[model samples]
Target chain A: MAAARSDRAPRRPTISDVARRAGVSTGTVSRYLNGGHWVSAESSKLITRAIRETGYVANSTARQLRTGRSGTVAFVVDEAPARFFEDPNFEALVVAVGDALAARDRSMVLLLAGDAQSAARAETFLVTSGVDGAVTASAHPEHQLFERIQAAGIPLVNVGSPTGLEDRIAFVAADEREGARLMAEHLIAQGARRIAVIAGPAHSPGGTLRPDAFTAAVDASASEGAAPVVIGLRHGDYTVESGRAAARTLLAEHPEIDGIFAANDQMARGAIDALREDGRSVPEDVLVGGFDDSAFAGTEVPLLTTVRQDFGRIAEELVDALDKQIDAGVRTNVIVPVQLVVRDSTVRPGS
Target chain B: MAAARSDRAPRRPTISDVARRAGVSTGTVSRYLNGGHWVSAESSKLITRAIRETGYVANSTARQLRTGRSGTVAFVVDEAPARFFEDPNFEALVVAVGDALAARDRSMVLLLAGDAQSAARAETFLVTSGVDGAVTASAHPEHQLFERIQAAGIPLVNVGSPTGLEDRIAFVAADEREGARLMAEHLIAQGARRIAVIAGPAHSPGGTLRPDAFTAAVDASASEGAAPVVIGLRHGDYTVESGRAAARTLLAEHPEIDGIFAANDQMARGAIDALREDGRSVPEDVLVGGFDDSAFAGTEVPLLTTVRQDFGRIAEELVDALDKQIDAGVRTNVIVPVQLVVRDSTVRPGS
Candidate 1:
């Protein structure tokens, strides 16, 4: 099919051609492409039809120069290259965001600012690269690229609620605190008395909020006559290996712990592996729950009972929020809802 | 840290400021930014120092207008969005490519041209958006976007050996046939007579070359008295679900099949799951092997015995090739080597 099409390659149609075909000026065609706000409805219809008939593809670079809008958004990650690819959640979010942006005729330029030098480079790129805005999925609160982007006056939307810049920048994130609270409560309801939590890095929003909320929920549900509900706490870097190491520490420190809530599915899988190696059964010996119902969650030996963050919706909201910022200079904070998913990992076989 | 930096915002420096500071013309500054090939060494050093002192980040839109280079490369995916993310191989390649490009101070713009309409939009974007070049990871042989990109006189680097357009476009791919042959030989050496192959989509390069090579290897190793080696053949869509379905069909048709080779790690995982469900112990009742030793391969219960494609090196070679194309207008084809990793999945448990 590609070969057949290549046999008769015609010169690409331009905006002038579209204007000529539609019997309108090039300015009218340009106005229509930028956003037909000033153009009449009838003229817009004629231009649209002309574009279809002539296969006119507006030169975005020239349009960008004229309108000062690039129709491109940067998806920046401030983690190491390996970590960025290792996390399934990141992949899901990227794909979702890419799809959402593509639907709006916008391109997603990936920027990985792993270290201080890279951050500086990325900041420079963000400022000068003609990208209209940026959506950051970086977990590090200390990442200074955001400050530089803000200084450059680039509209921004963060995937997770950025810690220091929460109030300043637009963001779309899952309800991390509420989701963790529900998971803690669910574990309690499943008859777990001594529950432990494997938290993410303290610097990250999800890392801090999830553990804090879980601790609060567990403490609030404690009965006056009952023993303490919490047993141990361990911090992980939101990876399977870290989760395993944390789980090992938790088991060694507090053998009486009956439940574990991992910050994410990767950690939960790691914790499960640790438990299995230590001769403990899932849900039977210790109830294990995770966050982020990613693709791997369902395929686990004991399917993960996790908190589902709607990544697709979050991506749509991020693009929508970024679009609003670009068009109207509005900064909106959007927190998408989360859901609890019970699976074999948390529920006992007979129960 | 971000908060601290936001207190004192400095004005971003421009090319004119760099030129004034360096005591050079704006044209000299532009030449330095665009590779410094024609600039004097003394002038280049002064421009570099001036850029550092003034923190001048060239406005890429204006720079693009002057140089006809966008400083952005489109990473086009012709497959569905979900498949692009679900496969760990794709993630590894993307991360590697992104890192390589980042090292060269280039941004990777992701373009998902999944279906016909999306492909058309992507083609238009590529033609009109002023992207410097494109790197396609599309497996589809008939993807029209490649032809459009070619017609637009844009440099392209395909991740895999795209069928039909292999000679026209530059590509960096693993030696798929050699890798498959090695896996086939490994399985045969493990005393597996009744081997079965779960192939990828027939249209893809890996889909055709891998199975063909495996068949050739098995046939070459066949003895005069030997009846038949391959007892069953099933095609998969390079996905876990497809692998599981295909494995079921293969098992049901040839219950005596003692070996299974899946085209990729995801499908190998699904094949393992299917074998476990059917009460077939790996390497004991039925040996299983996979290609692309991805992140999931190592984490599997019986660590996968697979063919490892060095995606990092492939990515480096891709960027290197693309860089050459951008600078010297040279198109090069790179075929990286693959290795067979032996693990418990293919070898007997005691062995």
Candidate 2:
């Protein structure tokens, strides 16, 4: 079919050419391409043959413009671009989202809204880019990006708990409280007496919900007549360096700190580095745990024990919700499960 | 502008509606939208005004379909999806390419052609998806994907040296030979007597070019009266585990090896891990160097010494070449240089 068309036109075929070949109005071809919303089945067959003959693959994005669908969704993150690589947690979710979207035959465009300039640029682009919808990991307090997306009438799926925008936007999140509690129980089981926490930023859900849950778990254990453990909390920016800095401050204030739970793996590795600098042996002198068993989790010398979120399920759910939202115009919230993965950091030798 | 338009249209505007308002054929409106190609100045003004009034934000993709342009490009990586996160090098390049593409107001759709099914899907999608062009890091023996993209008449840009592809396919590459020589000389200066090389897969340009250059440099140094150095070579799949296995094999065969150079940072880090497993201290027992100063480079215990390719410049060059090829039908080749970074891995303490 392509070879036959090759001899007919030196340049690539256009919609007008496809329409002409099909002996129909350009609107018929355009409508046929855009989900065949108003086109007849007879016109649809003609248009389909026209496309095969003309080799019109750009029909997907182009026809969306002529009609209402855009055939693409934006996977947005409101953080510094480096966070995508630095944190490794994003990688798992992004790939899973990409794969899931690909399976659904939807193209994914990544949009970064870290700084004010990028936020403004992303705002303008989202309004004009003709994207079908967005899946955002934006925890920014202002809800500026969300408002822009909403105002543009794009369906949105948020990651983590809601921030009280409108009730209409959907969200998918992991059971963070359960994850944190599991890690705390494991630490207490390992005979940790003085526990220090390296939490993520205060504004983020993981920053607050995780540590709050761990504290509650510890209090519950104390209520059951278990021996009391000294617990202190400090905040980090979810980076390894930030983890190291937070650990330094924790050690300064609580010299007897024997166990640490970092909000994420990068920070957990940082905490371990600080302990090693102070000549402390992991699982011997101190027990440490991290959240998000990322690619960097196992590389830590002690092979970090961490909470593993079901990113695969989260990605699938996010895509599923958005797909349904686009078709059914319904909003839903979903919470995926988490598991505790034990390794050298939290498990004592020969125990 | 958005405020007034929002009140006017509950449904997204279509090209036919814009054409009706502009008092012109849908073809005329589309031609104007594409690039104002054959549309007269008066018609272009009319179509532009109608699009604004109707809130036709999907004009970009739609107009491109009516015409012959896709307005999108494929960034092709023929590797497993895991490689994107596992090997930090791809992250840097992918980001750089994405940023460069975004700056030009173009969308980049990533295509993975690692396995047979994915490669077939990617091939069919590229030919039928109407992407304007593609920048490929493919070194697969078949060149099957390249042939498909070319037959589809999309512009192509290759990364690294060519492998007998058509002259029309542009390429942007880092000088692997010079990078290898610099690393080899640095190791010789560190007074290394026995060196083993961990090369990437033999089919790849990096796999062959880097090791060949390093061997040539070592031989040239030996002729210039440098101490005799025994060099052993083994191949890996540009992975950490593969590098570890390669290093183990090299060590067992040549136990006197005092220095090692892996083609990339991931492998170099793996070699260090192997040396440590044998109770050999980095820089004291074996000096090590790596290529591609990826994010993983600095994370190694001894802070890897590596050759830094100008990924930023390479990305820029690749985009520039493709842009020109898409416009002027000219293909070009660009070779970016590299620099060596000295870190703890190669430098002995207190030297």
Candidate 3:
């Protein structure tokens, strides 16, 4: 189609030229390009054909100016360069978000929120940088800049819910409770009586969700007078170091614990490290499971059993929802699903 | 200085309002603001005072159009997300480049040369997307695109030298040969008699330089009849997995080796894992060093002793060079220095 149009114009025809040729406004052409509006099918066909015929390349800057949009989305993550690299979810989430943004011809700007100064700077950019929307990973509940973003009228999407913001703002996150329940059920089915969990920071939304849900699931599954032992809960900052520290504490507190669940992959890797240091054979001595089916899950020596949250799919939905709001002034609430990924970490002996 | 001139129009003001009040043309005002390029210094000072009085913000885009120059620079890197995140040199380089660009009131656009398709698309944008100049990484050599950029009159600055393109292009890079020599000398000083090397992919320019220089340095250090045994050389793709696989093979083939040098940090990490898996304690049985003092180097149990390339400083120089070319039409070469970061990995027992 583009080739056929190439012969008619020396240069690519622009949307404004098409609008002039079709006797329609530039906004109408823009509406046609960003689908899901009220444009008639015939009008849509005409616009698409015109775009093909002229090989029209949308002037992103002009379109942004006319619509008071930047055609850009910003994403912020809690960052320590080392932690960011080691976290398997970080790579997956960024790739997913980048892919989603590229599909909509929108660029994704990354903001690494680490210190107070950088956070404030990122907030200023988020509000004033002309981005249409934002996606943030609220690792800590008390992040000040995220609050500023919430108040700035930009459509903010959360990869995981932030404390205090969940009730006031819309978010798209994994079903943490269901995923935890699956982990608990798997342990019970494998005849593991004593279960311990290495959780993330106590205040984080995700950290709180998995442990509480797992505890409740365990409580409900036990028969009268034969309840399974809840060994211990240890906290980590979703880093290998913190994970390793938590694992040592958990092991010391409950040496009889037969099953372990870590909230993320880095922590899970730390757990593996601790187990090795303590001379405990994986799956034979203790079954382990982790959250976030990151890229390294399959690559681990004893492959990590994890909860899979399709970050790319969620990212695509987030962009679609934001684009809808930008183009048609519509709003949406989306909930992404999570699934348990069983691997070498969770399998019992002889199973 | 900005507050000195208020409410009064000095001979030639910095802005149009100032120019109007001072009874001068806007062109004269612009020339004055551009540091008396075509105006007297007296006129420039008067214009500055007028600008101070009016509190005028320079419209960079408008100024760019008027001057037929874009206040923007392009930074091109390989599209590998893992490399982008894990390579400390790349991160430091970008931050430094950003600082330099910001200092000149310009913005840096990140261009990804991921694959042939994306590379082609990015090349099209880099040449025609209003960027003033470009800083390209030689690691991902796209010679054809480099030639096209040169033809487009875009001042090109390369990070490293590549085949067929050296001497023609301006470049800023660390002294790879010197860094390799220092690393080899350090290993020799630590009394390592048998050294096995894990080299990066053979295709990259740095890969060839580092290994060749290290071998020469090692040869030079050896006295008559006391040359250290060159155990083995294995190649990796500068990835952690590749490093691990290569390390495993190197260890299997050369069990007597007392020293190891990885071409980069990612490969060094793999060697660490391989050595640990084989029950060889680092710094006691084997001494190891890596290139690129990346974040991973610090995160390890015993931090890696490696070559520290001042990527940020180099990036600053690259941007400064590009700006000089743009503002004064000066072209020059910049050579940044590299340092050896000593850590626990290369330290021998007792010594």
Best model number under TM-score: 1
lDDT (tens digit, per residue) of candidate 1 on A172-250: 9899989998998888888788888899887676578888898899898864445537788889998999999999999
Clashing pairs in 1: none
Q: Compose the digit string of candidate 3's lDDT tens values, residues A61-167.
A: 33454664545566777564345555767777877887776655545656665544345445434432335677777545455555656544556767776556567
Predicted candidate 3 versus true structure: per-residue lDDT over B1-351, tens digit per residue: 434632221111124566765566788875543423466535544554554344332322234446744555667775555567656666666677766665554455555455443444444444323456788774455435565456445677887655445668777778888988999999988878789888876656446888888888988895445577557888887888888898899888878889998989888888888899999989899999999787668777778999998877887889877767766667777878899999999897578
Tens-place lDDT per residue, model 2, B1-351, is 543532212233566877888899988865554434477657755765665455555422333445434446678787766776677767777788877876765556566556544554554445444456788885476646665556545678988876555365678888899999999899988877688999988667668889989988887785345464646999998888988999999999999998998998888988998998988999998999999898857775789999999888999999999877776778898889999999999998887
Please write out the lDDT profile of model 2 over residues A1-351, one tens digit for every residue.
544532212233567877987899988865554334576646756665666565554432343445434556667787766676677777787788878876765556566556544554454444444456788885576536665566546678988775554376689888889999998888888888789999988767668889989878876674333464646898999989999998988888988998999999989989988988888889788899999888857775889999998888999999888877776678988889999999999888888
Chain A TM-score for candidate 3 is 0.78
What does candidate 2 score in Cα RMSD to the true structure? 9.1
DockQ comparison, 2 vs 3, better candidate: 2
Error of 1 at B293 (Å): 3.5
Question: Which residue pairs collide in model 3, if any?
Answer: B13-B47, B14-B47
Q: DockQ values for all predictions? A: 0.16, 0.18, 0.07
